[model samples]
Target: IDPGHGAQDAGAIGNGLLEKNINLEVALKLQSRLHQAGALTVMSRTSDTFDSLQTRVSKGAQASADIFISIHANANDNSGANGTETYYDTTYAAAHSVKLAQQVQPRMVSALGTKDRGVKTAGFYVIKYSRMPSILLETGFVTNPIDASILKSTAAKDRLASGIATGVSNYFDVK
Candidate 1:
């Protein structure tokens, strides 16, 4: 699990919420859920510390994780662009990434009751270099008031984490 940003790199900030904090909270929740389910999880950072993008990819690769999931909160200058989306790097592991995103996106929408921005292809460094079924999940746009509210709620974060964990289990047929 890779939480998007930390420390000096605070990522997106809006409505009194820091994207880095939200990312870590959700990532930790997901890590706990996966652990309780008997799945091994390797976290890029378990605290409010920074990890280089290359280091994040290295951790996933070094662990030989079956899937790499990067948790993030989105930001939009428009502030009206609100929704949940998942990203996969088509230049790398397109098919597996897409499969993971397909399983994850709708569940996120359903769990958070957020707009469905659907899955997209991007060349995010961590996901692109992971060499596995990798997905970078934008939980919601922090710049949007509605999304910011949802992202700030503990219940919503747990739901988001649960949804992602369920998606991962579904991807691996864990059960």
Candidate 2:
């Protein structure tokens, strides 16, 4: 699991919330859930720390991870832009990446009660270079009031984590 940014790189900031922090919290919850589901997981960073995009890709490569999931929150100049979306790159594992996105996207919407921005194709560095089924989840737009409120809730975070974990399990056809 890869939490997008950290430390000096706070990523998107809005409504007094830091994207890095939210990403890490959700990732830690996801790690625990995956562990309970009998899957071994490796995190790019366990605490407030920064890793270059290349470093994150290397971690996934070194671990021989079956799939790479990068967790992040979104932000837009237009605060009205609010929803959950998943992105996949066509550079590698394109089909599997799309399948992974398909599994994950709706689950996030259900968990966060956010609008469905749907899955999309993007050439993000980590997902593009990972060489495995990879996806980047834009959990919600922190800049939007309604979305931010939902994202800031502990119960919602747990549900979002559970949703992501369940999606991953479904992707692998794991019980």
TM-score on alpha carbons, each prediction: 0.97, 0.98
Those runs of model 1 whose alpha carbons end farther than 4 Å from true positions after fitting are none
Full-model lDDT for every candidate:
0.92, 0.96
Candidate 2 lowest-lDDT run of ten: 166-175
The numbered model that scores best in lDDT is 2
Q: What is candidate 2's lDDT per residue for 1-175, written digit by digit as tens?
A: 9999999999999998999999999999999999999999999999999999999999999999999999999999999999999999999989899999999999999998899999999999999999999999999999999999998999999999999999999999942
Q: Which pairs of residues collide in model 2?
A: none
Question: Residue 86: error of model 2 in Å?
Answer: 0.2
Model 1 C-alpha RMSD to native? 1.4
